[model samples]
Each structure stands twice: as C-alpha cells, then as structure tokens.
Target: MNWQSIKEQLITFLKDEVKKTGLTKVTVGLSGGLDSAVVSVLCKEAFGENLKCVLLPSQYSSDGSIEHAKEVCEKFDISYEIVEIAPLVNAYLPNMEHNKLRIGNFSARMRMSVLYDISARDSSLVVGTSNKSELLLGYGTIFGDIACAINPIGELYKSDEFDFARFLEIPESILNKKPSADLWEGQSDEEELGYSYKELDDALKLLVDEKRTKEDLVKFGFNSELIELIDYRIKSNAFKGKLPTIAKIQWS
Candidate 1:
C-alpha cells in the first residue's frame, strides 16, 4: 500500500492542518490499539515535543492495555500523562443501570471530554485516532472518539492499520493484539461488528470506494447479507461524521 509514502503525506497533513489552526501542539488519546499507536507516532514525528499523549483508562481497561500505551510513549519519547477516569465514571454510573453497552459508550464520551480539556489546557488541537473501517461501520461513539481538530489516520482503514502501523515501527505487542475499545470488560470490536475488519474493509472498499452495487457484490461471490449488513451500517452510522445541525434564522 506504499505505506512510506502515506506516512510522509500524513505527517505533512498534520503539520499543515495544525498550522492553519495557529496551533503548534496536539493532544491524542492513546488506546493501546493499532490506530492510536500509528497516530501517536505520526504526531510525534510531526509535532515532536509539542505532541501530548493522554492515557484515559477506566476500571475496564486491562493492565496490558495500560502497559502497551505507556510502551508506545516511552518508545517514541513522546510526552504523555495518565488520567484515571474510574471516579468520574463511577460517580455517574451509580444512578443508571449497569449495562456494559451504556457504560462503554459513556466511557468513550468521558475520554473525549478529558482529551478536549487537555487540549484546551495545552492550547493544542485534538487529533483523532479512528480509522476508516470503524468510521465507515459506525463503530464509534458520537462526539467521543470521533471528535478531533484534525485526524491524520481517519482515511486509513483498520485492515491496513496493522501493516501501516508495523511500517511506522509500532510495537509488535500492539500490532499482534486483538482490536478492542477497552470500553467495557471483554468488549471486542470485531465481535460487535459481527465480522472481522478484513471482511468489513474489503466489502467497504467495494461498497464505498468502488461504488459497486449489491448485485455486483453477489456476482463476486460475496454474500448479499454481508453486503446488506455493511450497507446498513454505512447508512445508519453516517451521522457520526457530521456536525450538529443548526436551523437557519434571519435576524437582520
């Protein structure tokens, strides 16, 4: 996929985007996943010491995930801070039912809140970590992980992240690990999507990039149900990518 070329382009994109914002620094949420690992390296290369990595872990976050997040920061020599969010989450969850899905979504929003606050404190932008696969499948919390001032990796699919992350010299421990949001205990991305990223990304490319129809997908030996499933996700979750709607009013 010519990852080296894309790497250079993304770095340049990061620099240019931040420059346009008159901000020299950016804060990224490192989730100990392939996407964040790759984005952190890119931000580090682009902004150097100006890059800040915030580790927002809750009780559901695994020991390995925390260690992996710290590993990336240490390996890259990037500046970072760990913010434990158990208290904040616990403070609110006591009033609601203890549903993992709800808790996970709430955790994601809380993480985003902290990231934005850090960015405000440092006068930096929030660089998002969601890849194309997740974005397309609507696999993220609105106004949460999807929120960012600029994203260098948004267009890169999850399927390509492993190879791209490896090219970026991401830790093998991170690259080899299964993809999870660490939102709740034992929450897996693929499991939630009901399909592996490769399966999803491949179909997404055909469905989104190639503009192929369901009939064509079926002709290519792709199951109609999988195509339909992907289609529904794209249609349903499409709202996550947009800004809030504002009604027009003439006051003059």
Candidate 2:
C-alpha cells in the first residue's frame, strides 16, 4: 500500500488541516484500539508534542482498553489524560435499558464532548480515529466518533489499517486484540456485523468501489439477503459521509 507514501500524505494532510484551522494543537479520543493508536501515532508525527490524547473510558470500557491507551501514549511520548465518563453516561442513561448500543453510543458522544471541550480550551482541532470500514458500515455514531475537524486514517480500510499499523510499529497487544467499540461487554465488531472483515471488505469492494449490482454479487457467492442489507446501509447512511446538505435558493 506504499505505507511510506501514505504516511507522508497523512503528515502533510495534518499539517494543512492545522494551518487551515489556525490551530497549533490537535486533540483525539484514544480508545486504546487499533484505529485510535494508529491515528495517535500519525498525529504525533505530524504535530509532535502538540497532540493531546484523551482516554475517555466509560463503564463498558475494559481495563485492558484503558491500559493499552495509556501505554500507547507513553510509548509515543505524547501527552494524555485518562478521563472517566461512567459518571456522566450513567447520569444520562440511568434506568435506561441496558442496551449495549445505547450505552456505547452515549460513551462515544461523551468522549467527543470531552475532547471537543479540551480542543476549544487549547485552540486545537479534534482528530478523528474512525477507520474507513466503520464509516462505510455506518458503525459509528454521527456526532460521536464521527466528529472530527481532521481525520488522517478515514480513507484506509480496516485491512489497510492493519498493514499501516504494522509499518508504524504499534503495540502487538493492540494489533492483536479483537476489534470492538467497547459499547457493551462481549460485543465484538464482527459479531455485530455478522461477517468477518475478509468477507465484508470483499463485498464492500465489489459493491461500493466497483459498482457491482446484486446479480454481480450473487455470482461472487454473496447471499442475496446480506447483499440487500449492505446495500440498504450504504444508501441510508450516505448522510454520515457528507456535510449537512444546503439548499440553494437563488445561486443557480
């Protein structure tokens, strides 16, 4: 994937975004997961010590996730703060159904809130950590993990993320851990999505990037129902990938 070139582009991208925003620093929510760790490294390389990592752990967040996040910060020699969001999430969601999705979404929103608050205080832009796979699948909350003034890894697929991560020398534990949003206990990303990345990426590549129709997908051994579901998600979640739509009254 020409990681060296990708890294160069990413560094330049961050620098341009920083200059565009007129911000001297960047703040990011570190989930102690592969995506965030890779992003944190990119931000560090781009802005050096001007990057701040905020580890916002909620009640569903595992100890391993928190520890891994701290370890990445220490290894990268970047500044970080561990903020517990269980209290705030709980306050808003108390007596709410123990819906893992709800809890996880709330956690994401709260963490972004903290990061944005810090970014405002420091005059820094918020760097997003969501990878392309999640973005494609509508797997992230709209204003939560999806919110970013700049995102360095949003274009790389989950598979490409792993390759780039290896080149960047991220920790083995994080690289090897099962991917999750930590929205609820025992929730694995693949399990929720009902397919492995190998399958999902292949389908997505054929469907979205290659413009394959359902008939084309079925010939490729994709179940029609699953193909239909993915097609719906892609169509329905188009809003997530776009800026708020504007109505032009007289410009034309």
Cα-based lDDT at residue 23, candidate 1 = 84
Worst 10 residues of 1 by lDDT: 94-103
User: Candidate 1: which stretches are off by over 4 Å?
Assistant: 250-252
lDDT of each: 0.90, 0.87
Please name the candidate that would achieve the greatest lDDT relative to the true structure: 1
Model 2 clash pairs are: none
lDDT of 1 by residue, 1-252 (tens): 898899899999999999999989999999898889899999999989999999999999988888999999999998989999999899999865998888888999999999999999999999999999988888899988888888888888898888888888999999888899998878888888788999888888888899988888999988778899998988998889988889999999
Candidate 1 TM-score to native: 0.97
TM-score for each candidate, following the candidate numbering: 0.97, 0.94
Error of 1 at 4 (Å): 1.3
